[model samples]
Each structure stands twice: as structure tokens, then as C-alpha cells.
Target chain A: MFDQLVAKLPVGICVVDEQYRLQYLNAFFLDRMRPDQRHNYLQQPLISIFPEQAKFLTRRIKSVFVLQHPSFSYWEQRAHIFPFKSSRPITGEETQMYQNMEIVPISGPSSEQKLACIILQDVTAQASYLMAQQELASALKQEHTAQRKLIKKLDSAQSQLIQAEKMASTGQLAAGIAHEINNPIGFVTANLATLKDYSEQLLNLCDALADKLQVTSPSLAQFSAQTMDTYHYELLKEDISPLVDESCEGLNRVRDIVENLKQFALEESTGWQLFNLHETTQQLVKLVGAQYKAPVYKVSCNPPNLQIFCEPASIKQALTNILINAAQSIKCKGFVKIDIRATAQRVSIKVIDSGVGISAENIKKIFDPFFTTKPEGMGQGLGLSVAYTAIEKHKGKIIANSNPGRGTVVEILVPVVHPEQRHECAEPLGGS
Target chain B: MSTESVLTADQRDALQELMNISMGQAANSLAHLIETKIGISIPKIASVTPEQLFSMISEQADAYYTRQSFLGDIQGEVMSVVSQQGLCEVGALLEYDAPLSQTDIQEIILELSNILAGACLAGLSAQLALGTNLNMPTLFSPRKANFEEFQWSNSLVMEVQFDIEISSFSMRVVFCLDDASLDRLTQTLDELLG
Candidate 1:
């Protein structure tokens, strides 16, 4: 009955004695091994049957005999020992079966030899689940890179806007100064005209006197005419014309500088409007970049009138910051491109520049307060710090993608807020 | 001094008595089911290594090995040696019919080890008034170990043999403790004996 039961077993049953020879191979074992080896391998050593795993099995089998302890190995460490084809050849996911083995020392009067037993279990499903999790982690790492660049651009625009604000205020002051200077120059010029008329009258009277002398007293006329000419005409005319021209020229230079400053610092209405994304992008690029002469700025928002509802002032500030950063990143003329995409739910503004990309170590600190890559006095390093502040206020997200020496791209997303949702003067940023 | 010296003679006797009572209960659980007379050799316990075990059971050349471990107030493993002869009859008595496949035989051994080892440990702990936990049963081969390479000294071992009076069935369960645990076991046994 025991012999019959061994033949009827579901799994392969093979027992090897201490000498490592096959003491018994049940029907299950015969059904799996090489057909010729199945018959011949009987009573033969297991090593001669499978030569590839010979060294590994030999060490393990010997340990079992030496320690007199049960030893086990699973598919987790070594998946395939005997490369038996999957029991389900047609529909199985695995080509080779995963196996587990056990070794034991059997003691009895008739058989004092030790035996080794092997069991196999399939585990394809669990392995695949673990692989899927790794893929997700890698994808997250990629998305995180993209988010950083947009934040950088926002920071730059903000800093540029601050500069623009200073320039604009200075421009306003220049205009006021021009008005105040004009007040005093008005009377000065009019009085100078009247004094020239009086001087002409006095010259006429002197001329008349000189004629009278010429007729009455020829000697007196000669003396008087010479004296008057020495004191008057040629000297006065020489001094006046050049002084007037120079005063006019100096005032004009001051006016021109003030105009440029005002343009740099232009402020718009605080409310939302359907502003043309393309036009605003151009204006922002021009405005911020006008002060920073470093990087080349390019604008491409095709269908130029791509309109979106946003506070134009803030949008300009955001873009200007990005463009300025692009400008600073380039040692020579490098391109900075502004792209605006309008959709039903939001607007995406991308500022891509061929600037020095942020380094990995510094990228983490980019959003940190007062972190700057600029030389002292050039910047307070509040650029990206402020950018992060603005993006958060707008319920938007900005990201950066940078490759050192290659370029950096900042992507900004502005949610389409309904009329009621927009807040004015809600603080530019909560101080990043 | 020696790890064994901690166990006084009186404490050792008490521990042996506790083992005899637990083994008696374990044998009864099997004997009542098989409807056969069951006999247990005076209970002997030992501290042994895999190599030491190989020689101890040299008489049962073709026998199967099954071990179950328990832990709680005290922790130890119950290793059973089943003689290859007439095991099928005992397997049948355990509700596993004859025509036994290798796996079926293994399954019966593990199940038998679980019930007997679990119950015996429970009884032993109760006799000592200590709580314990029993782990799962696992099969092993003792002859695979190299005795020469083994570094353990001749251990303080208390050994026992159990025999099934009917159906040619016989087995043994050896409870081995580490040296530190042996000392603790002696102290607990002394307290109980007192």
C-alpha cells in the first residue's frame, strides 16, 4: 500500500541516500525528468542527471549530511534549479516553474541513510506587482523635475518686476522734476527776450548820437563810435546762443532717460481683464528685458490674441521675472522664449531660455527665502523666492527643468478663476 | 562553573517528573484514537545539537524526523523521531488511510507532531505552572551534519524513548534547551518542587 501510494502522489517524490544516489523516484518524478535520463538516472547520482546546478546542490546536500539539519532553498533566491517547463505549457505566464526544496535525514534499521526532498510552488503574480510600484516612483521623479523650472521662471519675473517698479517710480519722479524745472525756465527765457529788445533800443540811441557827432563834430563822432562798438555788439551775441543750445540738450537727455524708466516700470489696472496672452508676453518680455541687456528674448504665442482673464500687472511681473532670469543666465546672447497656452480651465505660460540651468544641489534651495545665485549688490536673491510666493497666491503651480550650461524651462499654470474668485491687492506673495 | 551545574539533583528530578506526566498525556491522546495500548519509556530530556542528534537516533536508519517548537513562559522545541516500520498503521489510526503517498505520509507526520507536541508542551507547562507558545512543525534530516565539525561539548542531556504498545508504532520527543534556559528551567523546577 505504501509503495502504491508513492506512485499515486500528485507531486514529484524523489529520495536520495547519503551517497547522493537516487534511492527512489516516484511516478511524479519520472513524468518530469528527461525521458532517457528519467529511466537511466534511476539509481544514478542526481549530479550526473543535472550537471549545471551540480556545484550548488552538492554544497547544500553535503551540508545537510554534515549538520544533520534540515536545509531549505526557495525560488526567491534561486528561481530555477531544474529548468522544467511549466506544467501549463499553453496558458502559463511563466516559462519555467519556481521550485522549493527540502532535505531530511531518515533513520531506521533497514535504512540508516539520509534523504533529500524537493517541493516547487509558483509565484509569478507577486513579482509583477512589485515591478509596477517601481515604475510609478520613476514617473513621479520626472514630474517633479518639470515642476521646479516653472517656479524658477516665476521668481525671476517677480524680481524683474520689482526692478521695473523702482524704475517706474523714478520715471514718475523725473516727470515731476521736469515739471518743476519748467516752472523756473519759463520766466528766465521770456525775460531774456525782453532784455534783448532793450539792448537793441540802446544800440539805436547810441547810433543816432554817433551820427549827430559826425555832422557837428567830426572828432567827437569818431571817438564815440569806437567806444560803443568795443563795449557792445560782438561780445553779447557770442555768449548767448551756445548757452541756450546746451541747456536745451541737457534737458532732453533727462527726458529720454525718464521715458525709458517709465516704460520699464509701467503698472496696469489691478483687476482682471481678457488680456491677449501674446501681447502681454511681448510687453513683459520687452519691459523686463529692456533693463537687463544680457539675454536675447523671443516671444511666440501664435494667434497672438490668445486671451485669458488675469491681473495684467501680476502676469507681467511673473513673465518679466522669468525673462530677466533667462537674460542673466546667458553670458552672451542666448534665446529666451515665452509661450502662452489658453484653455477652458486654465492658462499655461512657459518661459524657456538658453541659460545656465540650476544645479541639482542648489535646486532644492531655489524656493527657499533669500536664496540667490547672484553676486552681492546685484540681487538680494528674492527672485525665485518671490516667484514661489506669487504662484501660490494665484492658486497656480510653477516648475523648473534645468540642465546646467544647456538651458532651463519654467512652466506656469494659472487656474481660470471666475469673476468672484479673483482677489486684488491680496499681497503679491506671502514672502517665500 | 558548568552550564549544567545550575540544575540541582532535586530540581532535575522534579523536571523529569513533569516531562513524564506530559509525555503520558501525549501518548494517551494517540493511543485512545488508535485503540491500541501505548507505552512511554521513562521520560528523559537532553540538550543536543544537530550533530549529536544524528548519533542518538542511529538506530532508526529509515525513520522520518519532524520538529515543533513552543515558546512562552519557557521556550523549547519538541523533536520527534518516527520509526519507518509500522508507521503506516499509526498513520491510519490518525485518520489518514493507508495507500499513503509520500506527501500524505509527510502531512500525517507534521499533523501528528503538531497535536502531540502542542498538547505535551501545554501539559508540561501546566505542570510547571508556566505559559508557553508552540510554533509550527518542520521536517529535517539529521544524518546530513558533520559531527567532527560540530563544536559543542558533551551536553547535559536528559533523554527519553516512547513506544506504542500496539500496531508496531514507536516515537520519541526530545526537549532541548540552551544552557541559559537550562539554568532558568532548573530554578523554576526548584520553586515548583519546594
Candidate 2:
């Protein structure tokens, strides 16, 4: 019964003598040994049985016997102590059995003699489970990153939707107001024309009155007639015409702002055209230079007559976001240098700012969406990432270099798309 | 009371004598095993802010850094800065494979830091008759240390560099003691001086 019980245990058990020789092994261990090994393993050295770990294991085993202390060998730091296959050769899922081993010294009565007993545990299932868990955790991490990206994109789309909704309602309000103004404008313009003709007749009558007043040569009567006649002519030709012109200018300014607002709200642009790069750069500089402080902006182009076919509106928004970032990076009076170079296949634009720069550690992660170092409400951290996406849409690359207290430089290389190659970005297919 | 003021020259002299003996013992232990001549510089003791501490480490190239924090009745970290120059040669002398990866280099650094720092602290503490617990060593990036980000400002530092002459490898081991431990260390040194 005891033998059967010993045999029933799953793993092979072995005990070695002080001299690194395998002196005893359980029935299970004996049975699992190869047919060739079983014939010769009796009273054989442990090294002979396991050839791979011979040198290291022998040295370790010597330490246990010498120190007369219990020693442990963990599969945690180094698993697979012995490369033995699983017992279930035909049906077992396991290819290799993970092992943990511990060695304890058994002292004999002689001062010179000692013995060490070694125990091995099969940890295949635990190792595989741990590996699977590690893989699962890593996969979850990757999925989490992907999910965060999707959520950021969703959030941007949501903000755009909200802004577009507001603009749409505002446009409706403007159209309504325009409708009201148009009716008044039509009649007022007609009335002004009629008024002008009336004023012309009145002025003619006044001129005749002035001329007649001058010829009569009666001082008091001529003075009263001339003062009244001059007043009528002055109202028509001198003051009223200029007032109308000034009002026209004021209305035109409002109309221009509303038109620009409409253009900015548009999600799509129908036509792509070859645009002057220098003119676009100047327009962008003017747009941001009016708003930000603490930084002076300078622009230089290598080739003046360079042009690129692009959606000018989207590209302009991208530039505006970046310039704003550069301006904000500076704490004190700092210089922002913009260098543009046109190559055969692409245009390279570099925006550099002398400001509080990024640290080396944070540089790698800056391109990740929503990873911002700016203080609360100063930035959403989405600007550079959005710029990245827009440039990527044009099959371009952007890089950032910075050192603390020195400055930051962002370089962008955009492939100059030809007119034939300009295509609108396709919307994501699924609503999700 | 002066808030992390360093020891005076006489105090430094007494502390240096204690360190010299302990460092010698540690070097003897390493030399016995590696069979190579190792040299230790006299301890240059100072009270430093954490920023100066980081700059002290970041200036070395082919050099990797590791830090081990010890806690007992007192607590602080021991930073071991090891140079990469002739490391493969030294690694060969120590029986590691050539052309190490960063992680392999890191593992080697951890092992070396554990051994040397463990010996150094044990020797120093044994001489002063104080108890100190040495923790596991981990690789550190010196340049990434933003000292302003740390809560603690001043530290009592005992810094020394050891060079193995058989090979061109050099390593600097620094001991940073907290305020309470500084008091303990100075008292212990005073007792040894007496």
C-alpha cells in the first residue's frame, strides 16, 4: 500500500548522495526515465542524468553540502531547470514542465561527511497560467491605448459637432437678420436714390437763390438768402454723401466677418487649388501675431516662387494651432523663428521658439493624444496631435526637438500634392 | 540645527579615517574574489541638495546608474554610478558574456551595486556600530532626475569612487543620509574618534 501510494504521486522524486551521485529515486522517477537511461542511471552521478546544468548545478549542490544549510532554486528567475517533457506523452497539452527545486543538507555523524537532499516540483500549469496572464495584461494595455485614441477622436468629433451646431443655428439667425435687413436695404437704397434727385433739385434752386441774392446787392436781404441757400447745398453735397459712404463701409466689415465665420464652420471644401506658400505664411503670421504676446515671429522662405496644391483652410488651422503653442511656450520675451524650404517633392516648414522647452523624458510621449504638459485650461494637449493627423493626411512627417530652458523646434515636411492628387479625406464608415 | 550643514575638517578627518578602513575592507573582499587590484579614493564628504547630487552622477558617460534605498532606525538611498568604459573587459574578468544588451548591462549593474554597496554599508555600519538595512538596487537615469520634483531638499552625502586597475572600469558609490541618520552617523564618528 505504501509503495502504491509512493507510485501514485505525479512527479519524479530523487535523492542524491553528498558526492553529487543519484543514490535513490522513486518508482515514478524510475519508470519515467528513458529505457536507455534506466539501465545505467542507478548509482550514476546527477550530472550524468542532467547534462545541461552539470557545471552550475554541481557547484550549487556543493555549496549546500558544504554550508550544511537549506538552499533554494527558484523557477521564478530561471525556470526550466531540467528540460523534461510532460508525463502524458500522447494527450497532455504541456510541452515542457516548469520546475522549482530546493536542496537541504543532511549532516552525518562524522565531521567530514554530509548529505544533501534535493526536491523538485513540476510547475508547468502555474507557469503557463502566469504567462497567459502576462500576455492578457499586455493585450489589455494595448487595447486600452487604442480605446483611448478612439475616445479622443470621438471627443474631438463631439466638440466639432457642438461647434457646428452652434454655427448652424447662428447662421440661421444671421440669415433671418439678413432677410430683415435686405428688405429695408432695398427700399432704403431706392429712397436714397430718390432723395439724391430731390437734393440735386434743391441744390440747383439754392444755387440760383445764392446767385440772385448776390446780384440784388441789398445787404440784410442778401445775407439771409445766402445763409439759407448755403445750408441746403452743404447738407446734400458735403455731409449726407460722406455719411452714406461711411455706413456702407461699416456694413461691409460686418459682412466680411460673417463670411469668414461661415468658411471656418465648413467641414468640407469642394475645391483644392495651387496656393502661394509665402502668401499663406504671411496670412497665418498676421492671424496669430495679433493675439499672442511674449514672442516675436520671423518668417523666411528659401524659394519665393514655390506653390503647393492643398486644402488651404485645413492647413491654415493646423498652422494656427502650432503657432499658438510656440507663443505660449515662451515665458518672457522670446523669439519665434519660422524657416520654410521648398524642395523638389515637398515643402519643409520649421517653427522654432526660444522658450521653456520640453524635458527629454516627456518628448517621446508628446505626440500621444491628450498628453499635455501645459497648466490647467491653458491647453487641451490636442493641438500638436491634431496637427500630426492633418499632416499625416497629406502623407507628411513632423518632429519636435527641445531642451529645458533653451527652446523648442517643430519641423514639418509635407509632400506637395499635385492638383490631380488632391482628394478629400474619406469619413470613417461606421458611425461608431 | 544649521539644516544639513556638512562636517568640519576635523570632523571630516575623523569620518574619512573610518571610511578609509571600511572601504579598504570592502575592496579586499572584492579583490579576493576577482583577483584584481582595486583602488579607492578618499571620501569627499559634503552636504548637498538633490540637484547637485544628480549633476554629480549625470556627468559620466558609458556609465549606468543604480540606487538602493536603505531603511532602519534611519533611511536614505545609496546611488552607485558605474562607468561603461572597459566594462565588457571587466565583465569578462567577472565571467559574463561580451557585448551586453542594456538590460544585461542593467542586470550586471544591479548585481555589482548590490555586492559593492552591500559590502560598503556593512563595513561602514559595523565600524560605527550602527544598524543599516540595504535594499535591492535598480537602474537609474541620472539625466531624468528632476530634483525640484523631490520633496526632500538637503542630504548629508559621503561620496567615493573605486577604480579596478586590472581593467579600466571605474564606479562611484554615494551614501546619502537623512537628517536623523546624519546625527546618528556624526555621533557614531565622534564615539570612534574618542
Candidate 3:
């Protein structure tokens, strides 16, 4: 009964003697062998029947016999040790069988008759499943990394949108205040000019009367001189004209500043236009230099008087914000250099400052809206963020490089003509 | 001190001789399996506190560790420490291919521990006419704090080192017997001396 059970087992089992001669083969092993060699295989060496893996097989069998312990071989290391086809070759995906073999030492009735038993199990399906799982895990990991990068980009874009909204509201408020101030400035200038004319005409009439009185009546002349001395008319006459002129000059200055404010806030003509970039940069330097007198401002433009097609106000505003930041960074004395280099394709504006530089930790957050190192209420921390948005609208890039206690250099690059504008320009020419 | 005095000098000497013979057999089995000459140091026997045992085993760095327990006439655990250096060469000797994977290295460590520990236990049991069964081996990493918290104060430990001639591969096998097993082992040594 035991012999019958061993012959019918599903796993392939075979026993070999100390010299590796085949002693026994169960039905499972015999069914896969050639019928002609089956009868003679009992007394032959195990390697003679399976010569493909002869080296590995011999080593394993010898090890089991000598060590008196089992030795294992998996499909991962050596796929197939025997010349066998898959059990379900007709339906299975694998063309050849994957196997795991175990060799254990067995003792016969006599001490000299030591033998080793070989057990082979098919594990094709399990190995295939594990490999598929590993491939899927790696694919998921790659997708997770890509999604993390996309999320970071979206986070930055959201903050930029918020900063743009804040600037829009501020611009609207300035526009309203500029319109109200223009009404009062118009009448104040006209009334001051009329009052100056009236006073000058009355003083001329008094001067003629005094001359007539001196010539016609000597007694009346004495009385007139006494009255002039009593009223201090000479001092009044000297100070009156100069005071009116100074008041008018002050009013004109106020009007010029309000006009600049209106132009800065105006959104009309936001479209692209050909601009003299050199003139714009020089004006910016003059404007900021007047306010911050300590910093020595210098402007250098290569290929002098280069022109670019961009929104004039926005470009001026972006440069203005950067210049202000540079000026404020100086504690005592420093210089702010605006270097404008223009190529046929793009314009590069580098604002270099010799002032207190930004710290490493704060540099990364500088572009983020509302991220400020300044004391509360001193700054809204929207200067760089606004500049960033303006540059982005023109499809440009802005970068800042700084060394603490040394200085900071901000580089801005804007294409001379945007890609969409280039396409539009080519369309009309093509049609013609 | 109490645990130290339990074994007489004659009994200690007799046990050491018996351990030497068993360790030789263990090394011989591995040498024959790998077709290479193997050398072993003289076996050392001592009664040690838990702290001493932990220090003795955990001091070696860059080594793979494994433990297997045995049952029957005596109960004890066997711990094996194999150096990580030159393990690829040793794996080749055991019929494993070059550039061993992590799994392949793990399997090699377990099998090597089982063979040496099993043979040593078998040789010792055969000499004393006692039956012993060894459980499967598993990887072990000991922490000093955990070992110091062990309930057993002292144990009798037997240690031996095996060195392969062709390779820099070396391993140390430490056998620790329980309190009752230690008494049984001493009695068995005395009987052998008689």
C-alpha cells in the first residue's frame, strides 16, 4: 500500500545512491521520461539522464549526501533544473515549467547504503503573480512622484492669483483718489493767477497817484509819505509778487505727481506697444534716486536705445518695484546698478545692489505673497510678488541671487515679442 | 558563584573533552559537504550571567546571526554568528551562484546554521545515548536592554569557532543550556567519566 501511494503522488520523487546512481523513480518521474530509457535508468548515474543541469545537480546531491541535510533551489535563482514542460502547457502562459527542488538525505537499512531523495515542485503561477505585483508597485510609485510635482506647481499659481487680485484693488483705489484731486487742483491754480493780476494793477494805480500828489501839492506830498511810512507799504510791495509765484510753483508740482499716479494706475492701453526700454529704465532710476538719495544709481544699456514690444506701464512698474527694494536694503550707503542688455530675441534687465542681502532661508519665500521679514505695517511684502506676476504675464522669468551681508542681484528676462504675437504678425503677411 | 560551583573540576574537564569531540564532528560534516578543509578552535565552556552572555554574542559587528532550539533529554538554544565578509565566496562553496541576492544570502545563513548546530547536537546526544530534536532556524538580532531584562540570571554556555581554509569565512556557534538542562548535562558528563 505504501509503494502504491508513493507512485501516485503528484510531486516528482527520485532517490539516488552515494555514487549518484539512480535507485528509484516514482510514477510521476517515470511518466515524463522516455519509455526506452526507463528500465535502464535505475542503474545509471543521475547526470547521464539530465545533462543540461548536470553541474548544479551533482553539487546539490553531493551536498545532501555529505551534510545529511536538505538543500533547496528556487526558480528565481535557477528556473528549471530538469527537462520538463509545464503541466498545463496547453492552457498556461509559461512555455516551460518553473520548479523548486529540495534534496534530502535518506538512510537505507544498512549504514553503507546512504541515499539522497530529490523532490521537485512546479511554481510557475506563483512566480508570475509576484513579478506582476512588483511591476505594479513600481508604476504606482512613479505616478505618485509626478502628482506631487503637479501639486507644488498649482500651489504657487494659486498664491500668484491672490497677489494679482490685491494689486488690482489697489490700482482702482489710486485711480479714484487721482480723479478727486484733479477737480480741486484745476480751480486753485486759476484763482491764484487772477488774484496776482488784480493786486499788480491796484499797486500801479497807487504809484501814479503818489507821483501826482508830489508834483501838484507839496503839503499833500508830505502827508502821503507819512501815510506810506505808517503802513510799511515798501516792504509789502517787495514780498507780494514772489509769494504768489512760489505758491503757483508748489501747486504745479502737486499736479505733476498726481498725473504720474493717474498714468501708473491707468489700465487703458494695456496691450503691447513698441517702447524705448532705455528711456523707461532711466526714468525709473531718476524716480527712485530722487526718493532715496543715499544710493548711487547707475544705468547701463548695451546697444543704446534698444526698443522692445511690451506693455509699457507694467514693465516700468516691475522695474520700479525691484529698484525700490534695492534702495531700501541699504542701511547707510550703497549703489544700485541697472544693467539692460538687449538681444534680437529677448531683453535682460539685471538690477544689482550693494546693500544688505537677503538671508538664505528667506530667499525661497520672497516670491510668495505676504511673506515679509520687515516689521508689521512697514511693508505689505507684495513688491516681489507683484513683479513676479507682471513678468509672468509677458511670458518672462525673474530670478534673484543674494549673499547675506554682501548684496543681491535680480535678473529678469522677457522675450522681445511673445509667441502668440509673432503668430499674429505672420498671419497678415501670409494672407497678402 | 553558586552556578559556578555546581560543576566539579573533573566534570568540567570531562565535559570539555566531550564538547571537543562533538565540535570536531560538526566541522567535519561541513567540510565534507563543501569539499573544503575546515578548522575549529577548542571548545570553551563557562557559566555566565545574562549580561555576560549578551556581551559575548553582540560585540561582533558586520555579522549575520541565527538561533535554533532543541528539545528532549536536554533543552537549550544554539546561536550562530557568521561574518559578513567573504560570504559570497562561502555561498559559492554551498553551490549558490555569484552576486547573491538578499533572499539568497538569508537562505544560505539559515541552512549553514542548521547544519552545524544540528550536527553538534546530534554528536553530543549520540555520545550520551540521549535523543534530541532540533527546530527550524530563524534570523536573530539581540539588543542589550532586552537581554538584560531576561528572567534567567545565569546559564552554562558552550562556544566553538569554525574557519574555512580557502576563504575568509568564519562562524562562531554558542550553545546556551537552561538551568535544569545544565544540571542534566553535568550529570551526564559525570556518568561518562565514571
Judged by DockQ, which candidate is best? Answer: 3
The candidates' DockQ values read: 0.02, 0.04, 0.26
Model 3: per-residue lDDT, tens digit, A25-124? 9887888888897778887999999898998789778767776766667776668888888777788777777888878788877977899999988888
Query: Rank by lDDT, descending?
Result: 3, 2, 1
| Chain B TM-score (each prediction, in order) | 0.84, 0.91, 0.95
The better candidate by DockQ, 1 or 3, is 3
How far residue B21's Cα lies from its native spot in candidate 3, in Å, is: 4.1
lDDT of 3 at A14: 92
Name the regions of candidate 3 deviating beyond 4 angstroms.
A30-40, A48-55, A74-79, A83-86, A93-96, A162-258, A265-293, A296-344, A350-411, A416-432, B1-21, B31-61, B65-81, B89-104, B125-194
Index of the highest-TM-score prediction = 3
Clash counts per candidate, in order, are 47, 1, 0
Off by over 4 Å in 1: A1-11, A108-111, A124-249, A259-432, B1-194
- For candidate 2, write residues A1-432 as lDDT tens digits: 976775566765666777788866666666756778876676789988888777546755764554333444545544666767765567767786677666666654565566676667788778877888999999999999999999988987675455445545665675566556656666765666677677667767867766776777669556866677766745556776667666666555445444443344342442466767676676566546656766888999889756778766556656766788888888779988888898788899899999899999998977766779978887666677667766786778989999889999989899767775444333333443
- Models 1 onward score TM values of 0.40, 0.50, 0.70
- Candidate 3's residue-wise lDDT over B38-141, tens digit each? 99999888888888988888888899998889999899999999899879989998888889998779878877887888788888887777878777677888
TM-score, candidate 1, chain B alone:
0.84
Error of 2 at A170 (Å): 4.0
Positional deviation of residue B8's Cα in model 2 after best superposition, in angstroms: 45
Local error of candidate 1 at A178, Å? 9.2
